[model samples]
Target: MERSHDGYDLFSPEFRADPNAHWAAMRQAGCPVAHSDKWGGSFMPVAYDDIRDIARDGARFSSRAIEVAGPLEAAGGLYLPPLTSDPPEHKPHRGVLMPYFLPARIAEFEPFVREKARKLAEELAERGGGDVVTDFAQHLTIAVLTKMLGVPPGEQFTDWMIRMIRVGPKDQAVRAEAIHEILGYLGGLLDEREVEPRDDLISYLAAADIEGEPLSRKHKIGAAFLVLIAGADTTWSAISASLWHLALHEEDRKRLVADPSLLDTTSEEFLRVYAPVSVARLATQDVELHGRSVAAGERVLLAFGAANRDPEVFEEPDKIMIDRKRNRHLTFGSGEHRCLGSNLARLELRITLEEWLRVMPDFRLVDPDGVTWSGGQTRGPERVDFEVVR
Candidate 1:
C-alpha cells in the first residue's frame, strides 16, 4: 500500500521501520527527488546509480555540513567531524585518522574483539537467551570503541561514554543537554591526555599536526565524539541486523557454520543488506541525474539502504545470499568519504559472528512484535530479544 505525496511523512515510525516499499513507490511515481522541509529541504534518492554517482563526485555534491542541516546544524561541533567536511579541509584530518583504522591496526586488536565477543556470547548462553541488540551488540561495540580510545573497558568512564554517544534523533532538548555534558567531559579527558599521552586514537589526534600546529581543543573533542558515535552506533546496528538475519535464516546459519571459510563473504553480504548509516548529501550545483534535475544547494539523501537493495545492481536484491561473489555494496559508502573504520567494523563483525554461532548455534526471536527500531539519520533495531536453545 502506498500513500499520496501529502500523506508521506519521512520521519514517521512506519517509514523508519521499512522504507524500501516507500522508496520503490516514489521511484515509480516519477518523483526521484522526494523533499522534506523537516530535514532542511533534503531530497531522498531512491535509484542505485544516482547515489553512487553522487558519492563519487564530491565536488558536485559536496558533503560539507550540508547534510546535517535543520536542527542538527545548531549543534555544530556535536555532529560527526571530518565526515561533515569536504575536499581539502576533510583531507588532513582524514589522512591522520586513516592509519589507526587500517586493516593491520584492526588485525592487532582482533584478539581483544574476539575475547569480548566470546565473553558476551558465553554470558548470553548461560542466560539461555538475550537481547542481542542491548546485551550483546551494544556492549561489544562500546567495549571495542572504548578500548581503541584507550578507555578501560567496563569502567565508569566507559559507561558514561556509551550513554553520551547513544544520543539519537529524539527530544532535541535532551539531546542538546547530553551533548553539552559530553563535550565538557571530553574536554577534561583531552586536557589529561595532553600531559600524559597514551597509545590510543585520542592521544594520536591530540598530538597530530595538521599544518605545523597541534590539533586544537575543539578539533580533539569533535574528532573524539565522531569516533565514539561512528565507531559505536553503526557497528552495533550492523552486528544486530546481521544477528537478526542469521536468526531468521537458519539455513544461512547452517551454511556458515558448515564452512567457516565463507565468513568473509558472509560478512560483506550482511553489510550489503543492512547498510546501517543512511547518510545524506547535498547538491552544490544544479545537476541532471537519470533525467531528474537537482537544483543548487538541494539536499539529496543517498538512501544507501535503498541503493544496496536496488534490483538493477543485485540479483535477487532482497534475498540474503551469504556467498555473493561480486557483492559491491555501499554500506561503508563510496569514493573519498568512504568509512575509515570499515576495516575495524569488519574485523569486529567477522569475529563476533564466528564466535557467537560457535557457542549458540540455534537461537530464535523471542517476540517479533516487541522488536523496536531507533529511527534517526542511521536506522537499526533498538532491541531484539531472542532465546538460545541450550
Candidate 2:
C-alpha cells in the first residue's frame, strides 16, 4: 500500500511510537500540503503557522465536512452535534451543551472527580503497581464521564464506551451496531428523565428548547454521544500521556513536586508534548497556505502534535519545561470548534496529577520497554506498567 503524500503510514509502529521526527522532516521540506490516499482525501499540514491560520479561519477551513470524511464520521455516521457542525448551526447546539460543562457546573463535579481519582489511586497503591494506562487512566475517565451523564457508575457503561470509542480501521457495520445499542440505552434513560427530570446533563438537554421547540430525540442522543466520547477518551489520553512523561523524566517530576504551583503550566506542556488527538478539518474553500495550494473539499489535518513542537513557535520545542510560560499550545484546538470540555479536562488532569504525586511521590515505570503505543485520531501509551515507591 502506498503511504500518505506526507510519507506517513498510520499503521507503522514507528509513526505510532514517535511522530515528531516525521513532522520535523516535513516542516523542513517547506510546509508542503501532502496528500494521503489512505484517508480518502486528507492532507497533512507541516508548518506551525499554516495550521494555526487554518484553525483560526473556519470560514475557509470548515470542520463540518471533515467530521464526515474521516474515521470518526464513518464510525458513528453523520449525526455528531457540535463537533461536526459549523458556525450558525454550531451556535445553538453549543449553547445547549455549554451550560452543562460551564465552569460553575464543573466546580460541582470537582469533589466527585477528586474522590474518584483518589479511589483509583488507592486501588493501584494496594496492588503496589499496575498498568497506569489501562487500570488507572482509562477507568478514571470512564467513571467521570459516566457519572456526568447520570449513568449509574458500573462496568457496563465503562466497557461499552471503551469499546465504542476505541479507534481502529473504519467499520461501518460494527459502528452502526454500537451506535444503535448506545442510542437505545440513551432513549430509555431520556424517557425516565422526562418522567422525573434530574439535574444531570441529559435531563438538561431533554428540557432544553431550541427555537422554542424542545431538542428532538436525535439531537439529545447525538449531543450525549459527542460529549461522552470526547469527555471520556480524549481526557484519558491526555492524563495517560502526562503520567508517561513524568514516569520517563524523573527530574521534571521532581521539579513539579517541588513546586506544585506548576501543575497548570505543566499540564499545558504535556498537552504540547503529547497532543493525544491529531484532529483533522476539511477545507471548505480553496486556499494557499505556506506555499502549498490546498483545494476546496480537501482534508486538512491540524497536526497538533507537530504544531506544538514547531521551532518557530517554541524554543527547545522538544523539551518538556514544567514551568513553561508564554505557552499558547493549541491542544484543545482553537476557534469556534475549540473543545467545550477543556475546562473540565484541565480540572480533572490537575486533580489526577496532584493526588498521584502526593500519594506516590516516588513511583516509577516498572517495565518501560514493555509499554506499547496506540494510535488513531488520538495517540498515547497503550499499556504503561508502574510501581508505587513509597
Candidate 3:
C-alpha cells in the first residue's frame, strides 16, 4: 500500500500543520523510505523499529550528514564532532563532556531550573495572559541555558540564542550566518577563559583534558556550537507543547493541577506525544530498508515524533497516558548518540509545567484554528496563545 503521493513534503502546509497525521498516512501507506527533495533530498523512516535501528547502528547509517545540505558545514555540519562523528572518535569526544550532563550533575541544577521557571511563570501570572512560547518558554529556555552553560545573561548572547532558536536554518545563508555568530560568541568566551578561567562550559571545554590533551580550538568550538544550537532550540518546543497539551485537554491539566506529583509521568507523556526533533543521518553504504534500496550518502530523517506514535511500540499510541508503563520512547534519542542534555531537558519541562500550572492552571489556547507550528527540523506552536484574563 504505497502512498498514492510521490513523496512526503516536509514543508507542505498540511504536513507542517500536522506531521503526526502525515506520519500516520505514510505508515498506513506502508512506505518506509519516502524521499523528498523539499530540503535537498532526504529519506524519512516512519516506523519505530527502523528509526531505532538506524539511530543506534551508526556504523551503517553515518550521522556525518545530519542534514540534507551543508548549510552549517563550517562549524561542523553533518560531521559535527561527537554527534556527527561515529564511534571510537565519538566516544572520546562525548566522554570528555559526559560528566557535565550526568544525571546527578543535572539534578543538582534543579533549584536554578525551578527558580527560572518560577520567575517567568509568576510574571505570566501577573500579566493575566500572553503567548506561552514568547512570554514563558523563550525566557525560561534562555535562563536555564545561561545558568547551566555558565554563560553570562548578556543582551547580545540572549538575543543570539533567541534568534538562533526561533529562526533556525530556514535558509542556507541565514543558517550559515547564525553558525558564524554562535562561533564568534562562543569563541570570545573561549578566549576569555584562556586568560582567566571560569567555572563554565566554555572554560571547561577550552581547558578540559580529552585523551590526555586539551581539545583543540576547532574541536572546542564544534562541541560548544553543538550545545549552543541544540540547547537553545529543542527543549523549548517540548515545554510549549506540554502547555499546548494541557491547554486542550482539561482532564489532563486538572489532574496535574490537583496533584503536581504526576508531573514526572505527565511530562514523559507530553514528551512522547510531542517529541520535538527529527534528526537526519547519511547512509554509509547501500542498504535495503523496508523493501527500498537506499543508496549511500542519502539523508535519512529519523522521525522521532512518528516513532513515538507507532502503535507497534505503544498501546493506544495516539492517546496521552500520563502513567504509561515501561515507557521507552526515543524522545531523547538512543544509543551513544542520545541527547547529551536529556536530563536537563526533562527537568526544564517538569519545572516549566509545574510553574505554569501553579500560576496559570486554567489557561487554554485562545483559538485552535489560529494555532500553527514551526516546521524546519523542530516542531511546536510558533505562538502558543492562551486565554488569560489580566
Report the alpha-carbon TM-score of model 3 versus the true structure.
0.94
lDDT of 2 by residue, 3-92 (tens): 234645654788778888777766666545666656455777766777778777868877764332245334224466888777778888
**Would you give me the overall lDDT of model 1?**
0.76
Candidate lDDT values, in order: 0.76, 0.77, 0.78
Stretches of candidate 2 exceeding 4 Å from the true structure: 1-5, 65-76, 290-293
Candidate 2, poorest ten consecutive residues by summed lDDT: 67-76
Q: Each model's TM-score?
A: 0.91, 0.92, 0.94
Best to worst by TM-score, what's the order? 3, 2, 1
Q: State how far residue 243 of model 3 sits from its true place (Å).
A: 0.5
For candidate 1, the 10 contiguous residues with the lowest summed lDDT are: 1-10
- For residue 158, model 2's alpha carbon misses the true position, in angstroms, by 4.3
Best by TM-score: 3
- Give the higher-lDDT candidate: 1 or 3: 3
Residue 298 miss distance in model 2 (angstroms): 2.6
RMSD of each: 2.9, 2.8, 2.2
